[model samples]
Every structure is written in structure tokens, then in C-alpha cells.
Target chain A: MFGLMTGQKIDRIPVSPFAMGYAAKVCGFSIGDFYANAKVNFRSQLMAADMHGYDSSPMYGYASIGAWEFGGKIGFPYEVGHGAPYVIEHPVETPEDVDRLEIPDPSRAGSNPISMEVAKQCNALGLPAVFQVGGFITFAGNIMEPARMLLWMIRKPELVHKVISKVLAFQKLTADWYIDTFGPEKCMVFSGGATESNKLISAKQFETFTLPNEIAINKYVLDKGIHSVLMHPCADQNANIPHYRKIREECGWRGRYVWNFGPETPLEKQIEMFGAHDIIGGNVDPPSFQTKSFDEVIMLCKDNIERGMKNPSGYILMPGCELPPLTPPINVHAMMTAARKFGSFE
Target chain B: MNEEILNGLADAVIAGDVEKAEKCAKDSISADMDAYTSIMEGCAKGMNVVSKKYECGETYVPEILCSAEAMNAAMDILKPHLKADATAVPKKIVLGVTKGDVHEIGKNLVKLMLEAAGFKVIDLGKDVPTEKFVAAVKEEDADICALSALMTTSMIFMPDVIREVKRVKPSIVTMVGGGPLSAATAETYGADGYAKDASVAVKVAKDLVRSV
Candidate 1:
């Protein structure tokens, strides 16, 4: 993965499959156990990485961990098949809630201790840990009503900024802690799930509200000597891709990076837009991963690999986002097989 | 002068200025302009411009949201003046995110666009149960039911919700959308229509209503 990101030649295409939920199934653990217990999370991640020959292990836990730490109500399911937990109550309801908000200490907050422990375990196992943290906009959405937050961006710009500032502070602290403990070289910061799709927010709004904080968090990791900043924006974020170039320029980011495009973004367009970057990760339709046949999945993977290789940038075979928790294992195997057969650099 | 006021009302909505929208609405009423005329020619017309800009990638969520707010403010002033017959019949829509999914931005945007297109929308909010969708449809006599889900986990609930709605009233058109859904999935789940985004949703809802 590092070799691909640094413009060095590698024998084959790097494949770091973002299989969080599928990993749990591989280790005979439930999604609930996988998320709540650090040991189980680490074991499943390692087992899945080894089984699939994944290049890196993703350290993604419950999406609402940070929000839960800061006073949001998160509900975890007990049974394995019941699916992942969700936020039942948001911490912020009104503009005044922004003023009342305080950053949670990363060392002791809700699930951060457990998550950090999992990262430590991964590093101890010699597995490269990609510490995935939620972006400011997504974390804010988790802690507050998402639609109200977007409206607040227009009606109460100051209040929105106030909330975002607090979230960014917490994000920076979390990133710093990971860098301090795991060391910058072994760690990659996946600051993602901004959820600010072009369909949802305009380029102007993205530039004004979302871009600054993205730059801040990415810059924080870069300054600490972390070269790989993996950005995962879900859904159709084709419009937001150009803004990332601006982010690269403003932050003076010279390090390796991965840009994961959503399904709506065609591979040709992704190559046209970001082919000059270090690593281009995706464009696979997540729904198809759940519904398509194994042969179909392999065909899709081959098509994407062929088109993605057309650009000089190193390509990683990954889902557009996290694989659907119920995605069939055969399809994932087919993806790796396709990558190896067609993605040989030699 | 009346035409100028109506144009100003549309311009206010396009600019997303709530106060300006309200003022122009009041001026239209005082000038004996038909409230429906003001809404169609002024507020909705302005929203049309916003929608165009949105489609052309010239505008985004925040601007569309502010414009929705501006249109609502104008509607508040003009609604009281509209004759009972003129306002009595607009197609009604029941909208919500599926159970276990708290994502509401997509649902809310669809609601806003549907309203701007002159539909009466009843938003059931996020994490709504399948039964609630059935209840809303039966009670509101809705012409369409729109379901949204952002997670793959939550998307499984969509087929159940669609089934419950069909059981209650097979006549009511059902539409589904969100981050993880595609038109094929929507068809597989038995939805009448699917839209990738809010702008397309409005047109889909209208077409669904007409087809029904």
C-alpha cells in the first residue's frame, strides 16, 4: 500500500478491501460483539485480512462512537443478526446547544478507549491500522438533526460554525493521539463520511463550510508525518471532487492520498478528475455488492480495474464505501481473484 | 405594478430572502392579485429558478433550503387569502426515512421540493415505522408515499414498509430513494418509482400521481 501511494513499482495492484461487517462474519462473531469488544474486533479484522489477503486492516467501529461520547444516545443491539447499533438521540437540538457543547477527552470518552485498544492490538499484530474517524459534518449530523444542521448553515451560520469548531477540535485531538501511540508511519487517517454530497450541498456551501475543517484535520495528520490520508465520501460526490484538489493546494498536502468515489461517479470521470493523484480507490456500486451474483461482481471488478488502470495513479480494489454488512463472501473473494488476475503490474 | 410585485416575490424566493418574500406576498394581496396567481407566478416561479440552478450545479443544499424557507414564508402570508376551492385540492404526499435509519436530509430535501411543486406534504420524520407509513397514507388519503434510507442495514426495512403500504392500499403510489438504493432495488422491493436525488423526486412524484 505504501509503495503504491509513494509512486514506487509494486508486483500487483494493492487490494485493501474495506470489509468491516464481513470480517465479523468471517471470525464467527456477531456485529454487536465485533463493535463492543476490542479483542473480538481485532481478531476478526486480522482473520479477515489474512483470509482475503487484504493489504491493510481498517479500524472502523460504530459510526456514532464520538457523538455518543459527547452526550448522544446510541443503542447497541445484543444479537448477532440484529445488525449494527444506531443513534437514538442527538446531543444538540437548538442553536443554544452549540454553545453548551464541550469536547470529550479522547483518552477516556465513550468508546474511544476501546477503539484505541483495538488499534494497539492491530499494530501489535503487525497489521497496518487505518484509523477511520468520522468527518466534522457527519459527526455534527450524528449529534444534531441533520436537516436542521443544513438549514442552520443558511439561517444560523455562526451557530453551525460554533458546532463544527468544537467537532474539529475533538477530531484533531483524536488524530494526534493515534499518531502519538501508533506512530505516523504505521497509521493512516481515514477522515471521511462527510455526507455532504453534491446532491445535498452546493460547491459554494462545501467550500465555505465543509472544506476548511477537512483541510484542518488532514493537515494535522500530514504535519505529524502521516502520508496516507484516505477520504471516503458516500453516495454521489462527483461535484465535491474538484474541491478536494483545492484542499490539496491550500493545505500544501504532498503526501500519498486515496480518493474513493461514489457509485454515481463513473470510473472514466474519476480518472479524468483525480487520475493525477497518488491512489484512486473506488466507484463500485455498494447495492450491487449486496445483490449481484459472484460472476457479476467479478465482471464489475474487472471493468473497474481496467478503466482505473488507464490512469497512471495506483489503483486499489475497494468497494465504493464499506461493503453492505450482508454482502456475500463469495463476491468479495471474486473481487480479490479478479484483482490478482487482471491487476498484475508485471 | 402588480406584475412587478409578483416578479419581486419570485425574485425573493430565488434570493432566499424570507422577509422580502413575505413583503411581496403582502403587496400582492393588497393589490387584489389572486393568491394562487402569486404562488404560481411568484413563489413557485422563483423556486423554479432555484431548481434550475440546482440542476445546472450553480446552487446546492443550503441555497435550496433557504429558498424553501423563503417560499414557506410567502406561502404563510398567501395561504390565508386563497379561496377554499383554490386551495382545497393539492396532491398530498407522505414522506419519511425507514425504521432504524436516522438519516433525514434526503427525505427532508424531497419534502421541500415536493412542496415547492405545489404538493401538500406530510413529513413523518426519521426512523419512522412501517405501520406509521400505512397510518399516514390511510389518514391523509395521500396520493404518494416516499421512503428514504441511507444505510444498507436500514434499507432492508424498505421492502417491509412497501409491503405494508401495499396491503393497506395498493392504489397509493410508493417511491423509494437514498444513499444505498438504486432503481433496480426499488423495483425489486415493489416500489412504483425511484429517484436518485430530490430534484428528480419531484418529477417522479408528479408522474406517479398522474399515472395513478
Candidate 2:
């Protein structure tokens, strides 16, 4: 994984199934435990990585973090169709609530304690620990209803900015705690940004709302000696490419950063937009693992790997998002199958 | 005066100015203009421009939402005045995000756009159980049943929901939308229709309603 992160010429390009709850279910563990239980989250992912022979580390967080962490209800994955924990009720429902909101102390926040416990496990075992700082825009939405956040952008820009600043502080301070505890080399900052995508806002709005926090967090972690960042710019963000370019110019570590794109933006376009230095991570449609047959999935993986292999810095073959919790193992195996067959440099 | 007020109302919705839209709606009422004309000519026309901007990538989700608020504000003023004989509700759709998927940003946008296009929508809300969707279809006698799912995980339930809806009422058109869905996937799931975005959803709903 480090070899892939450092852009070395390894024998084969690494494959990550991008499993979360899928990993838990794969290992006969409860999907709900994957989120609320630290040991379960770590052990399930570790076992799944070992079982599938995929080349990624077990991760410890979910995209829907802020609402729960900042004082709201969060639902664990108890149902067959649930992939990750979701915000059941946002902390700040009304504009008035925004004024009263407080950023929980990092050491005792909603799920940070669980997150820290998971990181400690990874650190003691010499594993690549993922420290999650969900993108500011998405986190802001997690704290409040997303539609309310967007409407606030027009009617109450100041209120929106207020929540964003508080959330941004929570993210940065949480990063500080992780880095202070485990040091940067042991932790790879993983950013998942669903709301930052153009699906919710335009590129200009992205520049206004998401870019500053992105640039700040990248620079912050880099300054503290973190060697890697895996940024999942979730959903269709073809239009936000131009604004994303600014982060590259300002933060300065193209090779160390891996930008994962979904099917919304073509892989080739992402490669070109990201340039020749940063590692690019995906393009495989996650839905295929549930819908397509094994051979069909292998074919898709091969197509993605071949396109990604052409990237100058490096490429990692993985699904664009978390695999469906019920994704078939044969289809999951197809990813490694394609990686071994077509991704070999030997 | 009615022409000027109608045009101004369109401008307010397009601008996403809720206060102005309400004022325009009130002005139309004071003028004693046809309330149906105020909706068909005023607010919906403005929503049309907002949808076009979305297609061109000139607008964002918040803009559409703000526009919806403006239109709905005007609607609150104009709806009661719509003469029963003149107001012919286009079609009714039962819409919600699929079970186990709580994300409803996409579903909400589609509902608003469907309303803008004059469809009477019965929103079932997010994380809706499959049985609830089927029940809604039967109870409302909905022309179309739309399901949304943001995760590959929850999207697996779509085909089953579609199947059950069809099993319960074969005449109802089933449609699906979300981040992970596509036109092909929709067909593969046996959906009668699909739309990639809210604006396109409005267009798709129109065609599906006509077919029904």
C-alpha cells in the first residue's frame, strides 16, 4: 500500500475493494457493529482484506460523521441494504440552533472516541491508519439538513458560514489529536466529500464553500508530516475539476495525494485534470458489483486498471464508492483477478 | 396589468426571491387574474428557466431549492384561488428515497420539479419501506411510483420495490433515480422510466404520465 502511495514501480497495481460495511458482512460480523464498535470495524476490515487479498488497509470512519459527533442521532447499519451509518437527526435543525451549536471537545466527541480506539489498534499493530476528516461541505450538511444548508447559502450566507467554520475547526482539531497521538507516518488522512460534489453545488459554490477547507486541511496535514491523503470526491464532480485544480497548486504534493473519481467524471478526464503527478484512484461504478456477473466485473476492472495504469504518478484500482454491503464475493474477487492479470508490470 | 404581474412573478421565482414572488402572487390575486393562469404562466415559467440553468450548469442545488421556495410561496397564495373546473392536476406520483437510504436531497429536488411541472406528488419521505411505497401506490392510485437510493447498498432494494409495485398494480409506471442509478440500470430493474437529474425528471414524468 505504501509502495502504491509513494509511486514506486511495484510488480502489480494494488486493488482496493473499498469495502466498509461490506467487509463486516463478508466476515460474518454484524454490519451495525462496523460503525459503533471499534474492534469490530478494525477486525472485520482486516479480515476482509486478508480474505479477499486486496491491497488496502482497514479504515475506521464513515462519511456521515459530523451530525452524530456534533450532537445528533446516528443509525447503525442493521438492515440488509444499509452500507454505512447515517444521520438520523441533524443537531442543528433550525437557523436559531446554529447560533447555539458547539464543537464538541475532540477527545470526547460523538464517535471520535471510537475512531481513536480504532486508530490505536491500527497503530499498535503497525497498520496504515486512516484518520477521517469529512469534507467541510458534507460535514456542514451532516450537522444540518443538506437542503437547509443549500437554502441557507442564499438566504442566510452568514449562518451557513457559521456552521462551516465550527465544523472546519472540529475536523482540523480532530486531525491534530490523531497526529499528536499516532504521528503522521502512521495515519493517512481520508477525506470523503459527497456534498462537495456538483450534485449539490456548482464549481463556483465549491470554491466558495469547500475549497478553502480542503486546501487548509491538506496543508495542515502536510505541515504536520503526514505522507498521504486519499480524497474521495464522491459523486458527479466533473464541473468542480477546475476548482480542485487550485488545491493542487496551493497544497503542493501531487504524488502523495490520491483523488478518487466516480462514474460521473470519466477516468481519462480525471487523469488529465489532475495532471501527471498525483495518484488517481478509481472509475469503476460501484453498482456493478451488485448487478454484474463475475466476468462482467472483471472486464470492467480491466478497463479501469488499463486507463489508470497510463497515469504518470500512479494508479489504484478500486470501486468509486463503498461496495454494496451485499456485493457478491465472486464479483469482489474479480477486482483482484483483473489487477493480477492486467495490472502487472512484470 | 396581468401580463406585467405574471412576468414579474416569473422573474421572482427565477431570481429565487421568495418575498417578491409572494408579493407578485398577491398582486395577481388583487388584479383578479385567473389563478390557474398565474401558476401556469407565472411560477412554473420561472421554474422552467431555473431548470434550464441547471441543465446548462449555471445553477446549483441550492438555487433550485431557493427557486422552489419562491414558487411554493407564490403557490400558497395562488392554490386556493385555482378554480376547481380550471385546475386539472396533471398526474400524481408517489416519490421517496428507497429503504435504508436516508439521503433525500435528490428526491426532494425531483419532487419540487415534478410539482413545478404541475404533477401532484405524494412524497413518502426518505428511508421508505418497500411496503409503504406499494401501499402508497395503491392508496393514491398514483400514475408513477418513483424510488431513489444514494448507496449501492440500498439500491439493491429497488428492483424488489419495482417488482412488488408491479405485482400489486401493473398499470402504475415505476421509475428510479439516485447517484448509483442509470437509464440502463433502471431498465434492468424493470423500471418503466428513469431520469438523471431533477429537471430531466420533470420531462420524464410528463412523458410517463402521458403514456399512462
Candidate 3:
């Protein structure tokens, strides 16, 4: 993974399936247990990494720790095994509510302590850990209603900024704590889900509301010498890739980030647009991976890999987003096999 | 003069200005304009423009939501003035995010679009069970059942909801959408129709109602 990120020749392409709940199920734990128990989260991730023969283990299973601590009601449904906990209640309703919000301590907040322990455990195993944080826009959306957040962006820009500032501060503190405790080398991968994709927010709104905070969070990790900052944007964001050039021009982002294109964004277009960057991953059809045959999975992986390799930057074999829980394991193996056979460097 | 009022109302909705929309709606009512014409031409026209911009990628969710809010504000003013028989006979829609899915934004957008297109929508909100869909269809005498699921896990429940709805009210057209769904998946789940987004959802719902 490091070799691929650095534009160095590798023995073969690094294929890491972004499996969360699916991984937990493989380790024989219910989704409810996985979210509540640090041991279960860690074991599941490790075992799933081993089973999938992936390049690395993700440090966090659930991404709602911060929101949960901020008083959002998180629910672990019994039937949705290993699926992400849904926010049953939002904490902030009005602009004034943003002022009342408090940032929870990373060492003591809801699920944060458990997730931190998981990171420590992953580090002790000499595994490179990918610590996931919800992006400020997503965190803000989680704490408040998404529509209300967007309206506040227009009606009360200052309140939105005030809340997002707190979110960013909390994120920085959490990142620093992880870097301090787990050691930056042992926890080399840092990712944030900017799921508030351009598909939902206009490019102008993204520039006004999302870009500054995104830059701050990414810069914080980069300053700590973490080179790989995966920006996971959900849904079709094909129209918004040009906005990244604005980030490069304004924020001085020099191609250290990897862009995870959502499934709807065509791979050929992604390769044509973003393959010149340091690292660009994804564009696999997640629905097909979950339902299609192993041969189809192999064909999908091979096609993506072949297209992704056309750029000199780097490519990682993976799904457009996290693999759905119950995605066929044989299909995952097919992805790996395809990477091994066709992704070899010249 | 009523045409001017209707035009102003549509412009307010297109601009997503709630206060202006309300003011124009009041002006049309005071002018004794037909309430149906005010709603269809003024509010729905604005939403139609917004939907077109959304389809072309010139606008997005937040903007469409703002426009929806403006349309709703105007509708609140014009609804009472609508003739009893005219308002009573519109097609009904039952909309919700399916059970196990808490994502409401997408579902809410579809509701707004459907309402703007002149349908009466009964929203069941998020995490709606299969039984609730069937109940809503039977209770409301809905012509369309629109379900949304953003997660793969939640989408698995769509077929169950569709099956139950079909069993109870075979005449009700079932449609499914969200980030994870494709037309093929919607078909595989036995959905009568599939829409890729809210803009397309309005057209699909209209077509389904017309077919029925």
C-alpha cells in the first residue's frame, strides 16, 4: 500500500476490500456486539483482514463515535447485523443549539475510548491501522438534521462555521491522541468520510461550507507526516472533481490525497480526470459485488485495475465504498485474484 | 393580472424565497385567482424549473430542498382556496424510507417533488416497516408507494415491503430509489417503477398514476 501510494513499483497491486460489518460477521460476532465491544471490533477486523488477505486493517468499525458522544441517539438494530448504527435522534435543532454543543474527550467519549483501545490493540499486533474520522460537514450533519444544516449554511453561515469549527477541533484532538498513543508509523493511514458529496451540495456550497474545514483536517494529518489521507465522498460526484483543482490552487494541496470515487462515477471518467494525482482508488459496483457471481467480480476487478493503471500516480484495488455486510467472500477472493494476475508492475 | 401573480409566485419558488412565495400566494388569493391555477402554475411551475436544474446538475439537494420549502409555504396559503372537489380527487402517494433505513433526506425530497407535481403524499417518515407501507396504502387509498433505502442492508427489506403492498393493494404502483439502487435492482426487487433521483421520481410517480 505504501509502495503504491508513493508511486514506486510494487510486486503487485495492493487490494484492500473496505469491509466493516461484513468483516465482523466473518469473525463470528453479531453487529450489536461489534459496536459495543472493543475486543469484538478488533478481533473481527483482524480476522477479516486475514481472511480477505488484504493489505491493512481498518482501526474503527463504526464512524459515529463523535456524534454519539454529542448526544445523538445511536441504535444497533438486531436484524441489521454489523451495519452502521443509525442516529435515532439529532442533538442540534436551531442555530442556538450549536452554541450549546460540547466536544467530548477522545479518551472518555462514547465509543471513542473503545475505538482507541482497538487502535492500540491493532498497533500491538504490528499492523498498520487506518483510523477513520467523520468529516466536519458529515459530523455537523449527524449532530443536526442534514436539511437544517444546509439551510443554516445559507441563513446563518456564522452558526454553521461555529459548529464546524468545533467539529474540526475535536477531529484534530482525536487525530493527535491516536498519533500519540498508537505511534504515527504504526497508525499510518488516516481517512475521513466527506459523505456530503457534490451530488448533494452544489460546488459553490461545497466551496463555501465544506472546503475550508476539509483542508484543515487533511492538513492536520499531513503535518503529522501521514501521507495517505483518503477522502471518501459518497454518491455521484463526477461534476465536482474540478473543485479539487480549486483546493489545490487555494489550499496548496500537492497531491498527497487519494480520492475514493463513488460507484456511480464511471471509472473511465475517474481515470481520465483524477488518475494523475498521487493515489486514486475505486469505482467498483458495490451492488454487483454483493450479488454477482465470482467470475463477474473478477471481470469487474480486472477492468477497474486495467483502467486505473493507465495513470503513473498509483491505484489501489477496492470497492467504491465499504462492502455491504453479507457480500460474498468468494467474490472478494476473485477481486484479489484478479489484482494478482493482471495488476503486476512491468 | 392573475397570470402576473402566478408568474411572481413561480419566480419566488424558483428563487427559494419562502417569504416572497407566501406574499405572492396571498396576492393571488386576494386577486381571486383560481387556487388550482395558482398552485399548479405558480408553485409547481417553480418546482418544475428547480427539478430541471437538478436533472441537469445545475442545482443540487440543498437548493431543491429550499425550493420545496418555498413551494410548501405557498401551498399552505393556496390549499384552503382550492375547490373542495378539486383537492379531494387528487392521486394519493405513500412515501417513506424503508424499515432499517433511517436516512430521510432522499425520501423527503421525493415527497416534495411528488407534492409539487400535484399528488397528495402521506409521509411515514424513516425506519418504516413493511406493515406500515401496506397499512398506509390501504388506509390512504394510495395510488403509489415510494420507498427509499440508502444502505445495502436496508435495501434488502424493500422487496418485503413491495411484496406486502402488492398483496394488500395490487392496484398501488410500487417504486424504489436511493443511492444504492439501480433500475435493475429495483426490477429484481419487483418494484413497478424505478427513479434514479427525486426529479425522475416525480415523472415516474406521474406516469404510474396515469397508467392506473
Candidate 1, residues B74-172, lDDT tens digits: the string is: 999998898878765889889998876776777887887788788989999987888899999999988888999887877888888888888888888
Residue pairs of candidate 3 with colliding backbone atoms: A31-A82
Q: Write the per-residue lDDT of candidate 2 for residues A1-346, one digit (tens) a residue.
A: 6787765668988888789878988899988998889999999988999998998887777888789889999998888778788888999988889989998899999888998888888888888667888488888988987888988987888898899889888888998898889888888888877888887798888888778878887787888888888888888888888777778788774438888876677878878877477888866998888888999999999999888888887888988887877889999899988999999988
TM-score of 1: 0.90
lDDT of 1 by residue, A129-149 (tens): 566564667677677766777
Q: Could you tell me the fnat of model 2? A: 0.88
Candidate 1 lDDT score at position B199: 71
Instruction: Please identify which of the two predictions, 1 or 3, would achieve the higher DockQ against the true structure.
Output: 3
Q: Show model 2 residue runs off by greater than 4 Å.
A: A7-9
* Model 2 residue A57 lDDT score: 82
What does candidate 2's lDDT look like per residue over B1-212, in tens digits? 88999999999999999999999999999999999999989999999889888878888888888888899999999999988899765688999988888888889888888888788999999888889999999998888999988888788788899999888889999888888888888999899889887878988888887787
Worst 10 residues of 1 chain A by lDDT: A76-85
Residue B152 displacement (Å), model 1: 2.0
Between candidates 2 and 3, the one scoring higher on DockQ is 2
Q: Which ranges of candidate 1 are over 4 A from the true structure?
A: A2-11, A25-28, A61-66, A77-85, A250-253, A268-277
> What C-alpha lDDT, on a 0 to 100 scale, does residue B29 get in candidate 1?
88
